[model samples]
Target: MHDKYASVVKILHSEASDLMSLAILSGRDPFRFYNGADLTSLDLTNQNLTGLNFDGADLRFAHLEGASFDKGSLNRSVLDAAQLHLKDGFEFNYQDVLQFPGKEILMFCMIRSSLIDEILIDFGINYSVFAEFSKISTGALRKARVGKVIAIETAQLIFNGVFRFSKTLDSKIGMKCINSIEQPCAKMLVGGNNKPFVEISAEDVHRLFEIRRRRIAHMKRERGTNASPYVDYRDTAEYLMFYKHLVDDIDFWTKFDEESA
Candidate 1:
């Protein structure tokens, strides 16, 4: 695979004066270890990029229509103004190893609340939460005896109540809360100023999950007693959106590490 890629890279470099334009017609599917390479503004329509590692590469303004990125690592790669349209069953594994360049702010906008929660919880990071209808504050709510508040972002909320602690120490207390449903609640510490923290109750998470379950149940009932194609496709798309950010974040962090090293 390495030899094939080396040949393609040489061809891409020698054939065309414009390297970006050369990559557009390189006919190199599944390029191996293509890192920090500039392929900006290339047209990669209907390309099969399965298992491609675009770590620390620039793909700005590239055309990726109908591209298959199943199991690809796009860590810390730039996709600014790039067109992306994937088919069904696109699998992507993204973590903190990816990064987004040229449009860092826009990349954050694409991240989902569930993905953020997964990343933070896996890393054992502390987060603050408030009511479902309220906001999260790091200062004022530290004094409240509410249930577990895991993490609070602008769009989504997470909580788990499985433990508790006294509110006496000079530092903030981390604990859990158990509701009548026998579910675990999460309370955590977050960053912010003296603003009031909106606490999302443990019941809210259960209720939201329950609502989603019922919605899917109803769809299955209407579509068929066995399965609903639309629900499956929708769920797949939602999952893809979450994975995209993970890949982007991983790429960003990897680049940071290299630069610092």
Candidate 2:
């Protein structure tokens, strides 16, 4: 069993229409209506996310190991590189089509989908408040994915705001069942190695925000000419490792223990 972070996901879709105006009015883009989800590096480790639509989403590099969900959840999604296992004790690793070695060098690299959900769900956040921050155009990130390549900063604001813009809800019947039983969710992130990582703090999330805000502000002031000192960019491997460590630390081996028992 695993923590799907599904309750947190409810924050993004709970009451989208009421807050659309504020979401549209804030930050850089002032008039876009969208509320669809695109996730990569999402840790759906042992939660039920049945029937969730992830069309046009980049689910590359997600940690789905030991997680259970209907296949329908990933409808029309891009799963270029993902770690998964439908059964207990199975280590699933998938490689993507991206990142070929260049110039006679033998190397391979991949990426997470870069959605806001992917970045924060692992922090054990209860996003009930963000659901009401503003109504979101869930389709905005998909638009950015298909229409124009968005700046990393813009994507951060979009995904982060979408969640903060959401409100948490009562757990679904299935989620309640899982919680009531105290079924421990797998603590590992999607990667080659299965290990528990570290626990994240509120400061870490806020730190990410402050860095992005300052960078975005500076980009606006300088007209997208230079990089911000505060923003620490993680390459694909590093990004995966950060999650791997974080996910690994959270009840990391519980699933394996269950399987071996």
Candidate 3:
């Protein structure tokens, strides 16, 4: 019952749909405080909704065509058959990989690196800047607790996470790296239209990965550190786009989705 409009809504029906309609007519979003509210087969097609909380609510067979799907709580709402335009980063969840495994999360990384490279290039970042991103991403992959077994699904999640990290660095840490290179290493880097870059061959990046892989292989940490020459720059930059809110599915009135989540 609406505390503010209970008197006005007294004449209205008490069913979920009737209450939902009253709530809408009362100029408030529909909210079911019970996260487990079963809202199966509600004719919610193409309706602009607000104040709707669907956290853990069952929306199976709900008609949601052309309506924004991110406006409610869907912590674990059944959303398989809903007609919605979902984006990749959303991945059909509240901007998280909460249900996906580490392997599946990592799978997205296979193409993530390349996409990052292209975008950086588009932004006029050069080899030095690119190398910094590469180093950061590659090293992070090694230290990630996602287990040694990387699969497509897991990689995608990891890759998306790393992609977000790079964006963050671009604003925070990338500037420092760019400044340092422009000062002392300007001559060694390739020059973009508006940025300078370092000389990093594909082989160099590959070597970095190889080093990270074998760093902990067949040896003790002390011995490895003493004899091995692998360098990891995980702290320099981090990936954070995966399991994050990329876009869409923004249930603002519900606990199902989170902007920071």
> What lDDT score belongs to each candidate, Candidate 1 first?
0.36, 0.34, 0.37
Candidate 1 lDDT at 209 equals 34
Q: Each prediction's TM-score against the native?
A: 0.26, 0.20, 0.27
**Candidate 2 residue spans exceeding 4 A from truth:** 1-36, 82-261
Enumerate clash totals for all models, in the order shown: 33, 28, 40
Q: Which window of ten consecutive residues has the lowest lDDT sum in model 2?
A: 90-99
What's the distance in Å from true for residue 220, model 3? 27
The numbered model that scores best in lDDT is 3
Q: Give lDDT tens digits, candidate 1, residues 1-261.
A: 586687676664575543333444465533334557787888777676643556557887777777655322443365673333221111212111022121111111122223334323433535453321134454423322232332223212122221111122122222111111011112212112342332222232233334445556666777785665555432311222233332323543343334333
For candidate 3, the per-residue lDDT at 137 reads 48
The TM-score of predicted model 3 comes to 0.27
Candidate 3, 160-237: lDDT as tens digits: 444444456656454332222111110011113333222322232333334334443433454656544433323100
Name the lDDT of candidate 2: 0.34
RMSD of each: 21.7, 20.3, 18.2
Q: Residue 169 of candidate 2: its Cα lDDT? A: 34
